[model samples]
Target: MNQRPDEDFEEDELELYEHHRILVDKGQSPVRIDKFLTEKVANATRNKVQQAIDSGTILVNGQPTKANYKIKASDEIKVLMEKPPRDTEVISENIPLDIVYEDPHLLIVNKPPGMVVHPAHGNWTGTLVNGLVYHFQHLPEMKGNVGRPGLVHRIDKDTSGLLVVAKTEEAMTPLAAQFFHHTIDRTYLALVWGEPEQDSGTIVGHVGRSAKDRKVMDVFPDGSQGKHAVTHWKVVRRLRYVTLVQCNLETGRTHQIRAHMRFLGHPLFNDAMYGGDKIRKGTQFAKYKAFVQNCFDLMPRQALHAMSLGFIHPVTKEKIYFEAPLPEDFSSVLDKWDNYVKHE
Candidate 1:
């Protein structure tokens, strides 16, 4: 019989969004690992089960193993990933999408700020998935396993940028493998609160959901909690108080860039979740505060954008790239900062 998934974990190096633990019944028959897990995990497919195995995300008795491993009596199994419940279905929405590129296998869309990528608890409608469903009949799921159709990766709701969607399993499988191997190039532009001491640097740390606030993420430099995340950043331009920086994600985790920037004490401007909404730099003059407040009013969301994406075509095997210009809010806010720095 299949057992319940247990999340009983210590401060281990692994940072799985959801951890499933299974105990093989003493009378259990020997069965292939991939086929075995397909029955055990809810809302999971054989393809995903195989992907998890190939990615070394599935463990038997605490050690990564191959899909061919046979289950036995008294064996312990664990699977790690963000899991969505089986019964949930993402409803379609009439929201318009900003499609940049499309072909038989895949498409790229420039997601605007304030739109959720997928349907979740508080956000059910008006999501990118909702819009995609309206256009594409059905798309392959991503690593999140939340019915995020054709999504290779995702940006935050408040952060606007480019995203690619896979239209076929032929495109989806390889794209997922690319993201897992970190071969997909993802570049972001962010307006940070303070200047970095170094012009270019990399932030390495483990990131997990904050203990105090479940709504946001936190950096655990000690590696005691969270998953290993790496971000490389270089200053694109310095606007005196704030810096326009380009960030390259080496590993994609929940809020990796935002949390890592916060760890460096240069949170993205107007990022309320990480405390960037408050003025963390510059003078404390009444005029300065008011100016910052005005800037805040102009761009209420975090000042981050997915600037570019580069990856090999999952089907054609050809190198493909796409980019998006800064949205009006981000560009306008930067203009204000430039004017302020010039007048200073």
Candidate 2:
């Protein structure tokens, strides 16, 4: 089955438009451009293709083409379309932010757990974007990007960590490019159930939304599904039943670390969505169970944090790095684990 056109595309964080490039097959017969695109582009209807052509967003060989234009073998096609607008308007909220680093071009913020990065279906207010709009007037919004104003990328609402925000378009572009090219250096710290067989290793798999549950991600080791993803991880500490690991991302995908860890038989501790809420290791003693429950209570959410980020300054053309200390809950849980292991 064909995937959505955007599914495999590498979109920049700040891009407001969808850009698609398709190369005609050599054995293809001449066909109407709109008809060809309608068949080639997943979920695209003829009417929508015609509308795109009418708006001159469809180009053949670098020039805008008509709907009725005949597509020849090896013809290069490009489609650019503005993203659809959201139904709800983004209202700026006076939510406080934890600024890590700031400059004229960009700023790094340590987002607390449970705060949405942008307004979405269930999260319509009190998001980081809403606060950003309130704190800074006229922050550069990507053209056609409705709700998000300055975000180049984002972390999950339940995941606490560092995120970089672009203050200007000049800053947004290069930063976005860095993410698209996998040049941004991001390291996450996660406490996961069970110790990995190896002290350090690289996990290579395709990560995509689960077929059974669209809400969460899954790893496709066969490469028959999903986008290519790579995660490098090394054990930082062994907590007997659980392990503290540092993960470095080579390709960013939704829940890449969580999904890959789950695939490795070591789901992140307390990650309910990936089945880490239950005890995956250790003894079945009532005391041990109670102790594990206390650890979960200490940090109810996934034991994951975006601890460090490094990249070339979009404006300065210089490399810079920033790190955020583990949040109180995460730290407290680690302490509990240490004490438990020591006594055992």
Candidate 3:
């Protein structure tokens, strides 16, 4: 897919205008029983033109009308323009990236919080995708597409952490295959409210789309599109009201850590979407409600970080590992928690 098109073939693929704007010339009275188009558009089949007129795409005197509307002499007419050859090319910019490791076949990056992994409706630019495209101008195809460039795995927008990107097709396939086989080592450090009774454990359940809200995921009672998601969490540190846990993903799913942790009664702190208002009291109970509130107010995103990543380097065929320390915001929260506990 990354193969460049032949020069002649590429030149032949030209963008063409869809519609034309024309004014009703003087003494040109409108008369349309059916099937008529202003001299601005082509490929307007009789049936489609009628449908367009019915839908009010055709306008006369700045007002939409059906196909039968008669045009008056010297009246203004505007046809909705259409265009062929949509822009499919992605532009690359030399945005600075936190490159943990880079080689001919792969690149590892510690993606910051709030950096979206891919382009979407509101985030077409300034994404990891855009950054990668810029960094590797001629990055080989991955997953049979050039748009993503080399995206082999993805973390949530707010989850800051190490991610391995394939630079070549050979690297992309193996990395992707490992992820499918659950061989890719991915771990997250999360500040979850409430301490689990157990020291370390696994949370396993079928995760599927939530029935109540399509935007969220829910644990399925009877498994549907729900796939088995597993997370092994070990308590790293216990705060006054929150516990820092290291979560290892056995099977990656949408919001797997967040949903599973929330299901296990330890939703990540300050996760307004899933943690709910009930978790607010923990911050309040710290005797620094105002301070905690201020800190939370200052925080830009979730309290989860991709702290550890281990994988086999595709080109060198050597094992590689990387880790990203918790960002300052999360660290500050922990520091405050420690201070409050010490005083108590």
| The candidate that achieves the highest lDDT relative to the unseen native structure | 2
Against the true structure, candidate 1 has what lDDT? Answer: 0.82
* Ten residues in sequence with the least summed lDDT for candidate 2: 7-16
Q: How many residue-pair clashes does candidate 1 contain?
A: 0
**After superposing candidate 2, which stretches have Cα over 4 Å from the reference?**
1-88
lDDT tens readout by residue for model 3, 1-344: 23211110100111113254557678775677234463335666777777766545566776667777777777666665323233535667666799998888888898887887765444568888888887786666554344666776677777778888888878877777677667778888998878889989998888765644434667763566567778899999988578899999888777778788889888888776676323444544554666667657656566888898887777777888888888778788788878877876
lDDT of 2 by residue, 137-211 (tens): 777765445568887778888799999989998997787778777889999999999988899999999987674
Superior candidate under lDDT, 1 versus 2: 2
> Largest TM-score belongs to which candidate?
2
lDDT of 2: 0.84
Residue 246 local lDDT, model 2: 98
Better of 1 and 2 by TM-score: 2
Tell how far residue 25 is off in model 3, in angstroms: 32
Better of 2 and 3 by TM-score: 2
Structural similarity to truth (TM-score) of each candidate: 0.75, 0.77, 0.72
Q: Rate the local accuracy (lDDT) of all candidates.
A: 0.82, 0.84, 0.70
